[model samples]
Target: MTDSASLPQDTQSATRPALPVRLKAGCKINLYLRITGVRENGYHELDTLFYPLSEPSDTLDIEEGAAGSGLTLVCERADLCTERNTLHKAWRVFAETTGFRPDLRLTLTKGVPDGAGLGGGSADAAAFLNFLNASAGKVALNDEELNEVAARIGADVPFFLKNVPARATGIGEILVPCEVDLSGFTLLLACPPEHVSTPWAFKAWDDRYANKMDIDATERLTLSAHMFTRPSSRALWLFNSFESVVFAAFPKLRAYKGSLIRHGAAAVVMSGSGASLFALYREMEKAMQASESLMREGVKTFIHHL
Candidate 1:
């Protein structure tokens, strides 16, 4: 649960870390996610809250390359080595916008799972963007300008730039700081083998709730924020809009959530679209108890004490 601020600010100092810079790109959990509407362009508008997690992160080792060497990305994971990967997009976009393309080589080690609805890829891209901007010196883009460039990478990329709890709206590019304290709670996350597609989740939701799409968007947005302000209503806010559609398609995921509750979780909900579930407990003992229970069933789990 380290704050994003804990990341290297040494990049700002005249004495920067030597040639090879190492950065940890963490993932995120969507505490509350609701689809408010779908734009004509087919992008879904969301009212969601993002909370960063340090575990299940990807590591990036970067070093300056010879001039005219361009950017070279190497990853053991074949899928991520492609030019279409978000990291490549981030580098290209940042360079086009800032004209500060440094010849560099990046090596990525993935600890996060793809399509787990954990925003792992987005986090990696944002981390790279921050590093590039810091290295750009006088050509560095300001926060607002950087966010605009990040949006081009992905909807969730901008959030990782600051990596704090935030309420995101309008296709997830817009962000505002939102603090929801969980000082005495423990978070236990269970990642099942299932990988849910974001596009499929949104389309399923649309087909199922098409008639309800025209409902008052403003009312829902106001309530989403207000729910966090009241501690007693926190349980009610643990809901995710994608669950109804996602669970119906993956029965095993539904059963896993039930198992978590039966094991003493105060509250449990699937993170983001699907494939991962996180539970909250008032005590770490209870969280550990739940973690062991799920692990015995052969499910991968992570425990974070807040």
Candidate 2:
């Protein structure tokens, strides 16, 4: 048996705690997002800040599956239940690479809204990877190796590999630890019913930005460790490139941002692409009140804090 200390601190060893394990794959809100230029391969480069929500939106209840060659994944959303999802795909790769039959059964409770730009899908996938890596008796990949596989699985998967906040670049794969202790502030996220297609949003962004050479995609994004060291309403700057195009298509989302501000948010912006709008504040009371107001008007909302 290899000592866990000898292994990376973030990964599992031959011995983990008892089974019937349950974990939450928390979603993320983009504190700052800027679209760089499109890659030669057609993937767009981006600069953004991904802050993990304190609340775990998706719950993964894992136990040994019926003796089988593969893993079983169950979810409420029919669209997400397929192997096409990040969780299932990650499991398959782990199983094949390890030659270890992963007879794990998963009961996933989906609290995060899909296509809301909240990274709900990525969160679930990351949670599964982390839990499996930690709980399985035999280790397949260390933290670095796991990240390489995660990067290939999805752009957002690597970010979810660790729960901390990060400054991301390079098509959302490059992650650097940029911890901003936002414990004192509350983030109120209001997810509207409409879902925005990220691909469409990107196309729109390209069309909009293609003409603007003034905006330098290569300009070094300057938010560093010192900037987010404290917990304050203004510690982090707020921006998202998707809002310009998304707000135009979804007027209700635009209106939601206005309402949160009118209700006393220090700052408000869309989370990633469209539909999900979040407001930052120093007081939980004001955040709750604002959420309640949106709830009264029939909007799905979530409150998170560090």
Candidate 3:
């Protein structure tokens, strides 16, 4: 097994003694996720609306490294320091594709929790990719090229490259900018202690709905061009297909959603797959009250005014 230290390196670090660049890796919430279809490659197609969240973000501090240092990653979480991490993979692959390898050291402080369907890892990788491109001088990749590289890194990494409200399709790689005005709404995000594996969640859905795959094709075709425009249709739009299997596997998540609703959330739904639930409120007071109520129950919470 080749460790990170054994990866390729260059002599650019000796001359490029630049200042540390700090970046905030923001998280995203899937306002609605529908598994539209499954491909022959076993990748599930999705029709989901992704809304960027500013609060509950991770921080990345990157600086130029010494000569022949390659890429060194030091994360607050030990497990993320490995080559398997998206950050390391981003650096490695970006270098391989563009040949703009620079010796650098990065320290990541994670505020977003993993395994909570928050897209924390993908956000981090996207941030790092942007950093690399910005610092790449003349060898930088363009927006389209960067997005292709981002997609290769992860299905959702390309979403964070722009980090705005987007409607995603085609295995969550194809992004279409959508207009979602949540100006007066406040989002109360609750993260439970339970950690849900995304792979397990998808497999569970496949097993339970093996025969019902074709049922969603019609809905996807009808709603592919739909936007969050009408107020009356908000209730119908506030849905996640993974909730059926995820809530069944983890009953506490369903109970938490009920708590958020009881505390006066206008709408509550699980973000991506499981382990985290968010509620929207027209009133800031109600959102804060719901946050306090969930916190009292030992759930970690974040309040972001959208």
Candidate 4:
């Protein structure tokens, strides 16, 4: 066993090339998400396909610490630190699990918009944890262990660790890697400045479905086998259980999706529970044109080909 604390001063001081690990964490769009049922433990059982998109993302950098006891974090956004920071929580859990006595300095460069349903924070945390685990030469935690810790931090963290499109179940932890090809398609993401509480979205869903249609049936068909056959199939299959709940509260988000359709998007849908909406275009030129138009309209937008 390699003891992180007992190494000789000379050995530790012989700088190992700075080891400044930088990782690009991808964002996701919930192509289809269904709230199957509520669990006894209060977590909702869900079925969803987490589609990785070539859009906005956050970058993380980690370097060996000079002399410290706990991890230190600096962020591009000043308000992002403190006890509520997801990266901080990930660092704490990793430190406790590996006993590596890490003196790490982490820097987060935020490009993803806050509360846009793009899983920005989750990506940052997962990337940071992975970088730290690799840097320390510790046994890599399997998917199960990684997800267990991820769920403790946030619902979206585990999905980022997978870093690919997957059909996720059980509060979004169960992953079935999909072989969907999005090579030529470009994604246009537009997010208006706003925030939506996940808990509140769930609560609104319960109220809306109290006497409504069957949610399971509506959601199940969208995730059926036919969805993987073609890119255009996504136009019919795009469904998010939180959309109704979110749209009822924030009508502008719904309008944004409509605008994407009018702007030549093949398919448009809300990314997660609330504000960010995305349009998938068959061509990169069209996507870029739409993104530029949205930016001029004062919406925060990103365009990328996946």
Index of the highest-lDDT prediction = 1
Off by over 4 Å in 1: 1-17, 215-234
Per-model TM values vs. the true structure: 0.90, 0.86, 0.88, 0.82
Better of 1 and 3 by TM-score: 1
**Residue pairs with backbone overlap in model 3:** none
Candidate 2 residue runs with Cα over 4 Å from true position: 1-12, 135-139, 211-236
Candidate 3 lDDT over residue span 183-215, tens digit each: 888889999989999999999988986455555
How would you encode candidate 4's per-residue C-alpha lDDT over 199-277 as one tens digit per residue?
7887898686533333465554454333322332247677677777798888777777767776788888777776788
Ranking by lDDT: 1, 3, 2, 4
List candidate 3 stretches off by more than 4 Å. Answer: 1-17, 214-234
Candidate 2 lDDT:
0.74
Report the poorest 10 consecutive residues by lDDT, candidate 4: 1-10
Each model's C-alpha lDDT? Answer: 0.82, 0.74, 0.82, 0.71
Candidate 2 all-Cα RMSD = 5.4
- Distance from true position, residue 241, model 1, in Å? 0.4
In candidate 1, where is summed lDDT lowest over 10 consecutive residues?
Answer: 1-10
Which residue pairs show collisions in model 4? none
Query: TM-score for model 4?
Result: 0.82
Candidate 1 local accuracy as lDDT? 0.82
Model 3 global lDDT (CA atoms, 0 to 1): 0.82
